[model samples]
Target: MKIISFGVNNFRGITGGLENNTIEFNNSNTIFLLGQNNVGKSSFLKAYEFFYKNTSAAVEDIYRMNPENVIEFELVLQLDEFDFQKDSIANKKEGLKKWLNPDNLLKIKRVLKPKIGAKISFEKTENYTWDYEQNGWVAKNYGGIGLDTVFQAALPTPIFIKAMPTEAEGEAIINEILKQKANANLEDKDRLELKEAQAKIQELQDKLYNPESIQSYKEEVNKYFQSLFPNTKIELSEKDKTKWTENSIGKSFAIHFEQNNNGEKDETIPTSHERIGHGAVRSAIFSLLLMKDVAEEFERVDNRKDYIVLFEEPELFLHPKLMKQLRTLIYKVSETDTPYQVLCASHSPQMIDITKEKSSLVRMTKHNEGTRLFQINDEFLKDSKEIKTKEELKQEMNEILRFNPFICESFYADEVVLIEGPTEEIILRGYFNEVQIDKDIFIVNCGTVNNIPFFQKIFSRFNIKYHVICDSDAAEVKELDNYGLIPFETGIQKSIYQQLKSDYEKVDYSVGLFHVNVPTFEPSHQQESIKDNLKYSNNYLASDGKPYNENLYWKDVLKPNLNSEEINTVPIVKFLKNIVDHN
Candidate 1:
């Protein structure tokens, strides 16, 4: 049971409009939710909880309180027969098969129906729909299964890690693990006896404490008190009568862990490390969730597919090393053979596992109208997958990150500008600091002239506002065509510009030439043309009456140009200013 996509309205902060509205999965299992503060990254996950996991939440609990408000949501699921086997009702398989169309997909919706505004006393209904290749969407007979059963069949057990985590969230999991480990200490016969006694004890415990079981008892007590009192009624609850804590399985079992006293002598301790920090507790829950068996357990129970987890800021309180480790583990778990998927809300770039063939990061933001979610993989980088293999793209991105981690800013920036090489990047970065006030724009060094086109292809594919600034080196391009037309670097630029023009009309570009006869960043003297890559240039005489080298020329030539009030007067920097300003 996996939720492919969902739509919610008038629930919590998601008011449902052109801004905050439907979320389409478009077929991704591991998803990363990215956003700024209060942009609905957390709210979206909470909405999923109420819509899918909180089966007992009433209309009053879910309906957003506002003028003329009503709550409704729909989920589209990619169904599988393997999960349908969990429905032990002999006829459940029949119903599952009947609902599963040729595409193996099912659509369901929850609505409090009554057109009247502010109406809470309306009929709640869950509708199921299927589609045919020719006839389009058709209603299905999910009537046989209750709304609760439909939910079970559609999605997995949702494990959510709240934005504000506490030790309480992980205590139960720890207790269960300790209890299971403790069973190893018992003899076979003793274990069996304990199991039987536990079952009997739980049975009695349920009878005394279960809300349904004690419902009549509470009503009778209220009636008895009401007879003695005129306008008062009794409210009763059932809890442990034992004043002292009972010696239950949990109390009897405990795990003694060795404590490293701040890297000093080790000591065996029985207490928890919860008081130490929030990071430890958050890591504990996350590590347990990544356990192999725990992941496998998320698979369909009794053959019915179901299980999922929502993690908000899983990287909180951890160092970069741990964050990377957790990120890798999450990638492994989400890719397992089980439908157990991991979707996390994260602000840390380290939480992103972009090495996967498929990109899973989804960017979210808030607007005046509502919140918006942009699926980066399906919307922008989808075409790149077809042109380049996953390995190929991963290698390129890894290499990009190796030298300049700042290049990764393109993943989050609203607009991206690609520069040809380090010289251009440095020059522009310095000038940008002096002029560009907008922090949302990014500038990346493309490493080489050839890399500009490659980077532009990706940005264009992603629908990002992209522009390029490259060195023309046109003055030195002496290669001649059959018509005696000299076109070398200029030819390459024309081809790239044409492609950019075709990809986006009115192409935005800025090309700069070295001092008329100069070529690359390393401009040597005219007599030493072959030494253009070297630091020293004989053309400009230094104060010591020596020809200037790359080092001397930078201080003598570059620094002054950069520090000038008219920094934008420089050809390349000026072009960059135009592209960035327009954007």
Candidate 2:
């Protein structure tokens, strides 16, 4: 079963309606939740944990701690033919026939209500599965199966990792994973070895057991039992079937660390779990998970399809290098043979990869109504198919990330400025930093003017307020050494400018689009003295057959022209300020 999406309402910090609170997996295995602090990103992960656990809700679990608020979670899962196979469902199709929709999708809703009074407790939360025939939710009860059992079989178990993990938490996770590995089916060779070992152990137990003494003890225990209940009797037996199973042996598993000091063979030290640092323990837990998934890639042990990892701040307690490695492992688990889906709430930009096709980026913000989720690729290239193919856009975005992963910082911003290159970015950033002291506007360098529309498509889809600034080059171009004429009405520059203009005009939200008017940024300034300095810089650099340094252009030419007193009055500075102020 694949989780398509889940919705939450009145759960903890999330009080939005079901429609606004919905998070779509979008057929992606890796979903990232990115936002500022207290935007309810962790709340979403906790809500999933709540759904899978189906435990009683504390009074604070309700939105605003209101008794009238009902915490609701709805999960939409897609089931395949394999899910209908007998191995998955004991009674096969008959057992799940009632819960499946026409498309074989299952929608399950869990609602929790708080009971008010001095002795506060929660009312029993019922599991309601969508009934295809009734076209609404009905209590899902398969024969005498418990609600938790039904869900355990139907959905993947959610492994929720909360932030601020301790050594004990890491040890607990390791223990559970080891148990899971032990319970999984073994190889034929290993199975044979274990069976032989078990048989020998049982033989020794049988030889040690005294049947006569055992009978005497059984009679003594049964004498008291018969006085009250004559029909019931107790028998103590040595059973081979229940002894030395893989899980039983697995319980003996323990993790230890050895350290060598100064490369001395004899000067080795051992460390216990409690001795390890929090970061090391957390990294060890993630490393074990990665190793398990990698092992499954070569040899799958279990047929379980429902394993969703609800991670909070996966980048916590790790170095930058390890954070990147963790991000890679996250992508690996999602792409590996194992049916593992990871939903992460992360604060690190390194944890995000907009290049990955099987990844979704969501940003959450606290609103008056509640927390609102903004999925960056919600519509999935809904607006820019004509400009670039999906693959082309992804490749471009990947290249952009390769050069500058910090571009992801834009996703966390409330407003963003998309510029053509570093020159525009530097100028605008300096101006915004000095003048717009209170506003936080993120400026992104799109490599070139051609790449701005691709980013525009992304920001627009997320409904993010953004501004675009680029040089509207003259309708002409120099290819190699040959100069060619590009018609103003039918040219790439015209096309891009027109697209930006149309976007700026049609969008009801705040947006700004500005063009340099001249061929490039340096000439956009009208000051003759600054123009003279630019000319001198270009001429000096021309002797070495090199272009003038962009940094020099800013420091020597631009900054000198506009001092602190005249900065806001300058045309370019005023224009840059206007872009951000438009919000």
Candidate 3:
């Protein structure tokens, strides 16, 4: 079974109405949540665990408080043929009902605090209802199996093995097993059983003491140790026969060390497992648990649809190189035929790079208003044009847009008006309304003024005509000039001011002019407008009552320049109309 979508409300930092946060899994068999630290990346993972397993472990603290702070998580699971076959055989049903039964589908949910318990609830697609007053889902099947049984059947069982076992523990277990298997010239049946038991004990001891033998069992373990402690070396030796000390019989293990520079031998070195660092210990434990889980799955003939794995900072206590390797490991595990779905939260950039495309990344950020979840969308990549290869493009687009969530693709517009910020974008949009211009012209704020060059490049590359309005700052002017764009400097109201600077002489034809300091004239004040057409706003005056100004001055400007029919109406409208006419 595969989860298609999930919804949550009043869950921890998440409150208000249903966020409708969903994840869709492809046949590619992977899903990743990519975001920076503390962005509810971990919270989403916990939510998945809480919903599907009904396990209070992930949400127990939140549940202890107000019962009304209830979190509702719903998953749409796609039932495969194996699930249908198993359910049909178990329930002994026939026809469409047998094939389409809710019980056969994996639908898991949990309500925190309100009802702190974990169990399978029969709320499959076929039986779903929009009625909110149901209080709870009608349980067609209740408490079928514990999460452990299902988890063990699906995910790798988590085994956290530290370094090799201590000599005392190894010896004690070995002696006990040896004593149990010991007998004098036993019969064939007893001898065979004893040998089998002896072999099992030896294997266990060998894993603890013999590095080479353990490598035979798990190659990853050896590789991990080598990468972690490059200077130290380990080997297993047989028990010394002549000097048979009582303390050393079952614990007959020795570690030999050689100095990095010299050939000097250290025969009495400490255990390699003990000498390894804490990070190495953690990695070893994680690897053992993962291996055990994989092995158990092979032992049972469970269908792939029933598996789910949850990881929290899998990169913790790991080196950058190892963290990268861990990512590859995650991908490898996900690619298996078993229905292995992995949800992990990580702060490392390496982790983000691993599954950049095949995941749902929610960026949680704080603003003056409050906390908000900004789902990373395709708009983030609107300024980027570096993607070349198909795979790179797919991953880049997927990473940013969440697969075209915007829905509406084509916007009918001839000329594009690009602004610097959201506020300006909104104000201009409203201004265009006052002017009664057709709304079809695309007016977009490329997020920041710095991105003007990028936006221009993209539009030019696509053969789209566009106009950009930006601040008169040196950097903004330089950027626009670099892109061969005309700058629309805000605020001058006299033709003399335009001719005062030679910079405007270069691009006078293409450039548009306006001033931040200039005052506007009403139709009734035509005589007054002629007398003081160059007057400035009080807000633009310095402490000396003179107009505060910038370096570059406009060469040609007029009163209410932007609205005048000869200047604003003809030039601006013609520039816009030309795009469609020429195209």
Candidate 4:
């Protein structure tokens, strides 16, 4: 079953009526919840669980809150066609009576109402009242199936594999399986009993020694060891392997172990589980459970339709490389016969890189009212030109800028000035005022020279007309050249004015630049005062007190030449005047 929509009410941080908050999964089978910490990503998952299983467990607990509290949650799910058809019952509403046909219509109608297939609830207590009325129909009918059974049977069991079993518990489970098989064939009078017993034994043996199973088990063991020793791999001896099976299963099983150290003697004897890291253990359990669930679904062959799998932080406790591998695995799983629809939440940029077009990303933010999930629009996708010309430049920029930083600033303007540092920004503003020009022209302090290429690419992507001003430092000149910005590596002030002169001659929008020369400013008394004022007043300015040069005062030179109230208005007015003169 795929969850189509959900609603939450008085649920911890989410209070009041929040209904019909729908999550539309990709028809192509992928979804993504892309948000930072604590914007209800986990709570959203809990809400889905709560809607299907309306037990009295604190719905608020799904969020970071007290378990005793109660919260109302509702979810809409789209079940497999077969399951829906099988569970559907005739509508029994009083108004539906007139529509019902007398000729066996009751029977047909009885099967027509939406089928309630499986109900699973997580209650706070055994006697807690389950709000069946609020639950999806599937939950209402399947409520008879205990929480454990429903979770095990209906949803994929591997989803909960993170819940670890104690050594004793693992033994008990293995033993129980053996006992069940033993008892089932106990009364067999023929050789069938022998065959069945042999089969059971083989199955258990395969689980122990099968390549995949062994690898998974080994990963789990290593995980436990890593938690105690960070940034280190545990060494396991052949004897240690023996001890693990001896302790976990029994000494009767043939186990192998290998020991290696960081070019040092192997002093520690670690079990397969012990040698493995804790992260591997957690992920292995989850992977194993998910695989098991997939196996079960394959065996049942009941609902062959697409399935939507919502994973909350699948990258949890995984290295970046491993996380990338996990993404590939998820994509592979979706390609199987029973194609899967996957929705995942992640904080890692690696995870973000894995997202494809089919994935729907929602960024969540906290508001005064409550948390809100905002769909990432196409605008967030860097434009085609930006993608083609400077993909690496854009990615690196995004890494440094952080996605949130740009969102906080104003980028909606048509004409923008990109400056290297806060000092330049302040000096330019003051110069603009001195020349009596409107300050409406958007001026962005890009934070650093290294980021200039990135912003330029972004502006080019959006087709925004923008000019960049930066120091003529040797490194800065080289960096700008790498970004296709031809730098005139002379004094900053002369270089900027020279570029402007050349640009005016070219009649091209791209032909504008700004640079500053520091040496000339030392003799000017006013320059020192300007530098001190910029250093003391503007918090965004760099700490180093750099004197401003003529390039910093370009706005003062240009204001009188332009005939508009707004700085951006000057260009538009000039264009209009040229157009009329040409006509």
Cα RMSD to the true fold for all candidates: 12.5, 12.4, 16.8, 15.8
In terms of lDDT, model 4 sits at 0.41
lDDT of 4 by residue, 294-353 (tens): 223332233323334556677677776677666665554444343455666666546553
Query: Candidate 2: deviation at residue 453, Å?
Result: 0.9
What is the C-alpha lDDT profile of model 2 across 77-187, one tens digit per residue? 887665665253645567677777678777778777778889556888766778777898787544112254544665766777768766456556655654454334344
Q: How accurate is candidate 2 locally (lDDT)?
A: 0.63
Candidate 2 deviant stretches above 4 angstroms: 86-88, 118-121, 139-148, 186-252, 260-270, 292-305, 377-394, 432-436, 475-509, 512-519, 527-550, 560-569
Alpha carbon deviation, residue 543, candidate 2 (Å): 7.9
Candidates ranked, most accurate by lDDT first: 2, 1, 4, 3
- Cα-based lDDT at residue 521, candidate 1: 46
Better of 3 and 4 by TM-score: 3
Q: Please provide, for model 3 over 229-264, each residue's C-alpha lDDT reduced to its tens digit, 9 standing for 90 to 100.
A: 454433334444422332232344333323232434
Candidate 3 TM-score over all chains jointly: 0.44
lDDT of 1 by residue, 162-226 (tens): 65665555555444432332332234465455566655444333332345523443344333322
Clashing pairs in 1: 1-305, 83-304, 83-305, 156-306, 156-307, 157-307, 535-550, 536-549
- Provide the lowest-lDDT 10-residue window in model 4: 106-115
TM-score of 1: 0.69
What's the TM-score of every candidate structure? 0.69, 0.77, 0.44, 0.42
The lDDT of each candidate is 0.53, 0.63, 0.40, 0.41
Q: Candidate 3 — which residues are off by over 4 angstroms? A: 6-8, 11-14, 17-39, 51-53, 56-60, 84-108, 112-139, 142-217, 220-275, 289-300, 303-307, 336-339, 354-360, 365-583
TM-score of 4: 0.42
Our tally of clashes for model 2 stands at 1
